[model samples]
Target: MSTTTSNHIGRKISRIRELRGMKQETLAEAMGISQQSISQIEQSETVEDEKLEKVAEALGVTKEGIKNFSEEAVFNIIGNTVTNNDNAAFFNNYPTFNPLEKLMEAVEENKKLYERLLKAEQEKNTYLEKLLSK
Candidate 1:
Protein backbone atom coordinates (compact mmCIF):
# COMPACT_ATOMS: atom_id res chain seq x y z
CA MET A 1 0.00 0.00 0.00
CA SER A 2 1.20 3.50 -0.74
CA THR A 3 1.86 5.83 2.17
CA THR A 4 -0.47 8.34 0.59
CA THR A 5 -4.18 7.61 0.69
CA SER A 6 -5.54 7.14 -2.80
CA ASN A 7 -9.24 7.92 -3.14
CA HIS A 8 -9.36 9.04 -6.74
CA ILE A 9 -12.85 8.21 -7.92
CA GLY A 10 -12.29 9.15 -11.57
CA ARG A 11 -9.42 6.70 -11.95
CA LYS A 12 -11.63 3.97 -10.54
CA ILE A 13 -14.33 4.73 -13.07
CA SER A 14 -11.88 4.72 -15.96
CA ARG A 15 -10.34 1.44 -14.83
CA ILE A 16 -13.72 -0.26 -14.46
CA ARG A 17 -14.79 1.00 -17.89
CA GLU A 18 -11.64 -0.42 -19.44
CA LEU A 19 -12.06 -3.77 -17.69
CA ARG A 20 -15.65 -3.95 -18.90
CA GLY A 21 -14.27 -3.71 -22.47
CA MET A 22 -16.21 -0.50 -23.00
CA LYS A 23 -15.01 2.32 -25.16
CA GLN A 24 -15.17 5.88 -23.90
CA GLU A 25 -17.65 6.62 -26.67
CA THR A 26 -19.87 3.73 -25.55
CA LEU A 27 -19.89 4.95 -21.97
CA ALA A 28 -20.63 8.48 -23.16
CA GLU A 29 -23.58 7.23 -25.19
CA ALA A 30 -24.93 5.27 -22.23
CA MET A 31 -24.72 8.33 -19.99
CA GLY A 32 -26.10 10.58 -22.75
CA ILE A 33 -22.94 12.64 -22.60
CA SER A 34 -20.19 13.41 -25.11
CA GLN A 35 -16.96 11.46 -25.42
CA GLN A 36 -15.13 14.67 -24.52
CA SER A 37 -17.19 14.94 -21.35
CA ILE A 38 -16.31 11.40 -20.44
CA SER A 39 -12.65 12.28 -20.95
CA GLN A 40 -13.06 15.28 -18.65
CA ILE A 41 -14.76 13.18 -15.99
CA GLU A 42 -11.92 10.69 -16.06
CA GLN A 43 -9.46 13.49 -15.45
CA SER A 44 -11.40 14.75 -12.45
CA GLU A 45 -10.22 13.76 -8.99
CA THR A 46 -13.74 13.89 -7.54
CA VAL A 47 -17.17 13.77 -9.11
CA GLU A 48 -20.49 14.94 -7.69
CA ASP A 49 -22.64 12.26 -6.06
CA GLU A 50 -25.41 12.53 -8.65
CA LYS A 51 -22.96 12.35 -11.55
CA LEU A 52 -21.11 9.51 -9.85
CA GLU A 53 -24.34 7.58 -9.47
CA LYS A 54 -25.12 8.07 -13.17
CA VAL A 55 -21.63 7.01 -14.11
CA ALA A 56 -21.89 3.92 -11.93
CA GLU A 57 -25.20 3.02 -13.54
CA ALA A 58 -23.77 3.48 -17.04
CA LEU A 59 -20.83 1.27 -16.08
CA GLY A 60 -23.17 -1.42 -14.72
CA VAL A 61 -21.62 -1.18 -11.29
CA THR A 62 -22.87 0.03 -7.92
CA LYS A 63 -21.76 3.37 -6.49
CA GLU A 64 -20.06 1.57 -3.62
CA GLY A 65 -18.16 -0.60 -6.10
CA ILE A 66 -16.68 2.50 -7.73
CA LYS A 67 -15.87 4.02 -4.35
CA ASN A 68 -14.09 0.87 -3.19
CA PHE A 69 -12.23 0.12 -6.43
CA SER A 70 -8.69 -1.17 -6.03
CA GLU A 71 -6.34 -2.37 -8.76
CA GLU A 72 -4.47 -4.62 -6.34
CA ALA A 73 -7.66 -6.33 -5.26
CA VAL A 74 -8.62 -6.93 -8.89
CA PHE A 75 -5.18 -8.34 -9.68
CA ASN A 76 -5.31 -10.59 -6.65
CA ILE A 77 -8.64 -12.03 -7.67
CA ILE A 78 -7.55 -12.67 -11.27
CA GLY A 79 -4.20 -14.16 -10.29
CA ASN A 80 -5.64 -16.40 -7.62
CA THR A 81 -8.49 -17.62 -9.79
CA VAL A 82 -6.35 -18.46 -12.79
CA THR A 83 -3.50 -20.06 -10.82
CA ASN A 84 -5.78 -21.79 -8.33
CA ASN A 85 -3.79 -20.23 -5.55
CA ASP A 86 -5.50 -20.95 -2.25
CA ASN A 87 -3.80 -18.03 -0.57
CA ALA A 88 -6.09 -15.19 0.27
CA ALA A 89 -3.91 -12.14 -0.09
CA PHE A 90 -6.81 -9.74 0.28
CA PHE A 91 -9.97 -10.31 2.28
CA ASN A 92 -12.15 -8.07 0.15
CA ASN A 93 -10.98 -9.64 -3.13
CA TYR A 94 -11.84 -13.14 -1.92
CA PRO A 95 -14.42 -14.69 -4.23
CA THR A 96 -17.66 -15.60 -2.50
CA PHE A 97 -18.68 -17.67 -5.55
CA ASN A 98 -17.43 -18.56 -9.00
CA PRO A 99 -16.83 -15.51 -11.17
CA LEU A 100 -17.41 -17.50 -14.36
CA GLU A 101 -20.79 -18.64 -13.05
CA LYS A 102 -21.78 -15.06 -12.34
CA LEU A 103 -20.71 -14.02 -15.85
CA MET A 104 -22.81 -16.81 -17.34
CA GLU A 105 -25.78 -15.65 -15.29
CA ALA A 106 -25.38 -12.12 -16.61
CA VAL A 107 -25.25 -13.45 -20.17
CA GLU A 108 -28.41 -15.50 -19.70
CA GLU A 109 -30.22 -12.56 -18.15
CA ASN A 110 -29.25 -10.32 -21.08
CA LYS A 111 -30.50 -12.94 -23.52
CA LYS A 112 -33.88 -13.08 -21.78
CA LEU A 113 -34.15 -9.30 -21.78
CA TYR A 114 -33.41 -9.20 -25.52
CA GLU A 115 -36.10 -11.78 -26.19
CA ARG A 116 -38.65 -9.79 -24.20
CA LEU A 117 -37.75 -6.62 -26.07
CA LEU A 118 -38.03 -8.37 -29.44
CA LYS A 119 -41.44 -9.74 -28.52
CA ALA A 120 -42.62 -6.31 -27.46
CA GLU A 121 -41.46 -4.82 -30.75
CA GLN A 122 -43.29 -7.52 -32.73
CA GLU A 123 -46.52 -6.85 -30.80
CA LYS A 124 -46.14 -3.14 -31.42
CA ASN A 125 -45.71 -3.72 -35.17
CA THR A 126 -48.83 -5.94 -35.24
CA TYR A 127 -50.88 -3.28 -33.44
CA LEU A 128 -49.70 -0.57 -35.87
CA GLU A 129 -50.54 -2.78 -38.88
CA LYS A 130 -54.07 -3.41 -37.60
CA LEU A 131 -54.61 0.35 -37.18
CA LEU A 132 -53.37 0.99 -40.75
CA SER A 133 -55.76 -1.64 -42.15
CA LYS A 134 -58.71 -0.04 -40.36
Candidate 2:
Protein backbone atom coordinates (compact mmCIF):
# COMPACT_ATOMS: atom_id res chain seq x y z
CA MET A 1 0.00 0.00 0.00
CA SER A 2 2.53 2.58 1.15
CA THR A 3 6.07 2.80 -0.17
CA THR A 4 7.51 2.23 3.29
CA THR A 5 5.26 -0.78 3.81
CA SER A 6 6.28 -2.46 0.57
CA ASN A 7 9.90 -1.81 1.32
CA HIS A 8 9.50 -3.51 4.68
CA ILE A 9 8.15 -6.63 2.99
CA GLY A 10 10.91 -6.58 0.43
CA ARG A 11 13.49 -6.36 3.18
CA LYS A 12 11.86 -9.24 5.00
CA ILE A 13 11.88 -11.44 1.93
CA SER A 14 15.50 -10.68 1.31
CA ARG A 15 16.40 -11.26 4.94
CA ILE A 16 14.66 -14.61 5.13
CA ARG A 17 16.26 -15.82 1.93
CA GLU A 18 19.64 -14.85 3.26
CA LEU A 19 19.02 -16.54 6.60
CA ARG A 20 18.15 -19.71 4.75
CA GLY A 21 21.54 -19.44 3.02
CA MET A 22 19.85 -19.11 -0.33
CA LYS A 23 21.16 -16.96 -3.12
CA GLN A 24 18.91 -14.97 -5.43
CA GLU A 25 19.70 -17.33 -8.25
CA THR A 26 18.76 -20.33 -6.12
CA LEU A 27 15.43 -18.85 -5.17
CA ALA A 28 14.83 -17.76 -8.74
CA GLU A 29 15.45 -21.22 -10.11
CA ALA A 30 13.16 -22.80 -7.53
CA MET A 31 10.44 -20.33 -8.48
CA GLY A 32 11.04 -20.89 -12.18
CA ILE A 33 12.02 -17.24 -12.57
CA SER A 34 15.22 -15.47 -13.56
CA GLN A 35 17.96 -14.33 -11.25
CA GLN A 36 17.34 -10.79 -12.47
CA SER A 37 13.71 -11.12 -11.42
CA ILE A 38 14.75 -12.20 -7.94
CA SER A 39 17.22 -9.36 -7.78
CA GLN A 40 14.58 -6.91 -8.91
CA ILE A 41 12.20 -8.28 -6.28
CA GLU A 42 14.73 -8.00 -3.47
CA GLN A 43 15.44 -4.46 -4.59
CA SER A 44 11.90 -3.42 -5.51
CA GLU A 45 9.36 -2.07 -3.13
CA THR A 46 6.59 -4.21 -4.57
CA VAL A 47 6.06 -7.36 -6.59
CA GLU A 48 3.00 -8.91 -8.25
CA ASP A 49 0.72 -11.01 -6.07
CA GLU A 50 1.16 -14.00 -8.37
CA LYS A 51 4.93 -13.78 -8.18
CA LEU A 52 4.80 -13.24 -4.45
CA GLU A 53 2.76 -16.38 -4.08
CA LYS A 54 5.24 -18.32 -6.19
CA VAL A 55 8.15 -17.08 -4.11
CA ALA A 56 6.48 -18.05 -0.88
CA GLU A 57 5.52 -21.48 -2.14
CA ALA A 58 8.98 -22.15 -3.45
CA LEU A 59 10.50 -21.03 -0.16
CA GLY A 60 8.13 -23.26 1.83
CA VAL A 61 6.54 -20.21 3.35
CA THR A 62 3.10 -18.65 3.06
CA LYS A 63 1.93 -15.76 0.90
CA GLU A 64 1.32 -13.60 3.96
CA GLY A 65 4.51 -15.00 5.46
CA ILE A 66 7.00 -12.83 3.61
CA LYS A 67 4.80 -9.79 3.90
CA ASN A 68 4.33 -9.90 7.68
CA PHE A 69 7.95 -10.13 8.82
CA SER A 70 9.62 -7.77 11.29
CA GLU A 71 13.21 -6.90 12.05
CA GLU A 72 12.34 -6.70 15.72
CA ALA A 73 11.84 -10.45 15.58
CA VAL A 74 15.43 -11.08 14.58
CA PHE A 75 16.64 -8.63 17.17
CA ASN A 76 14.56 -10.13 19.98
CA ILE A 77 15.96 -13.50 18.96
CA ILE A 78 19.65 -12.54 19.14
CA GLY A 79 19.18 -10.81 22.52
CA ASN A 80 18.73 -7.45 20.86
CA THR A 81 22.42 -7.61 20.00
CA VAL A 82 22.19 -5.17 17.12
CA THR A 83 19.27 -2.83 16.66
CA ASN A 84 17.98 0.02 14.56
CA ASN A 85 15.30 2.21 16.06
CA ASP A 86 14.24 2.82 12.47
CA ASN A 87 14.39 -0.84 11.47
CA ALA A 88 10.86 -1.40 12.67
CA ALA A 89 9.58 2.10 12.07
CA PHE A 90 7.84 0.98 8.87
CA PHE A 91 6.74 -2.38 10.37
CA ASN A 92 3.95 -1.35 12.74
CA ASN A 93 3.18 1.31 10.17
CA TYR A 94 1.82 -1.81 8.49
CA PRO A 95 0.94 -4.09 11.41
CA THR A 96 1.02 -7.89 11.46
CA PHE A 97 2.37 -10.45 13.99
CA ASN A 98 4.30 -13.47 12.88
CA PRO A 99 4.07 -16.82 14.79
CA LEU A 100 7.42 -16.31 16.44
CA GLU A 101 5.90 -13.82 18.84
CA LYS A 102 3.34 -16.32 19.94
CA LEU A 103 6.02 -18.94 20.42
CA MET A 104 8.11 -16.58 22.50
CA GLU A 105 5.16 -15.70 24.68
CA ALA A 106 4.52 -19.37 25.29
CA VAL A 107 8.13 -19.93 26.24
CA GLU A 108 8.01 -17.03 28.70
CA GLU A 109 4.92 -18.42 30.29
CA ASN A 110 6.56 -21.82 30.67
CA LYS A 111 9.58 -20.25 32.30
CA LYS A 112 7.39 -18.44 34.79
CA LEU A 113 5.60 -21.66 35.65
CA TYR A 114 8.90 -23.43 36.20
CA GLU A 115 10.08 -20.65 38.47
CA ARG A 116 6.91 -20.76 40.52
CA LEU A 117 7.23 -24.50 40.91
CA LEU A 118 10.77 -24.16 42.20
CA LYS A 119 9.76 -21.48 44.66
CA ALA A 120 6.83 -23.58 45.90
CA GLU A 121 9.12 -26.56 46.38
CA GLN A 122 11.53 -24.49 48.43
CA GLU A 123 8.69 -23.23 50.60
CA LYS A 124 7.43 -26.78 51.11
CA ASN A 125 10.87 -27.97 52.15
CA THR A 126 11.16 -25.13 54.67
CA TYR A 127 7.77 -26.03 56.14
CA LEU A 128 8.78 -29.68 56.48
CA GLU A 129 12.01 -28.79 58.35
CA LYS A 130 10.09 -26.51 60.74
CA LEU A 131 7.53 -29.26 61.41
CA LEU A 132 10.23 -31.89 62.04
CA SER A 133 11.98 -29.61 64.55
CA LYS A 134 8.73 -29.12 66.49
lDDT of each: 0.88, 0.79
77-129: candidate 1 lDDT, tens digit per residue: 78867643554443447688999999999999999999999999999999999
**Clash totals for all models, in order?**
0, 0
TM-score winner? 1
- Candidate 2 local lDDT, 40-101, one digit each (tens): 88887777898889888877889787887665666567656536555663344643776788
Q: With candidate 2 superimposed using the best TM-score fit, by how many Å does residue 4's alpha carbon deviate from the native? A: 9.4
TM-score of each: 0.58, 0.51
Quote model 1's TM-score.
Answer: 0.58
Error of 2 at 5 (Å): 8.0
CA lDDT, candidate 1, residue 94: 67
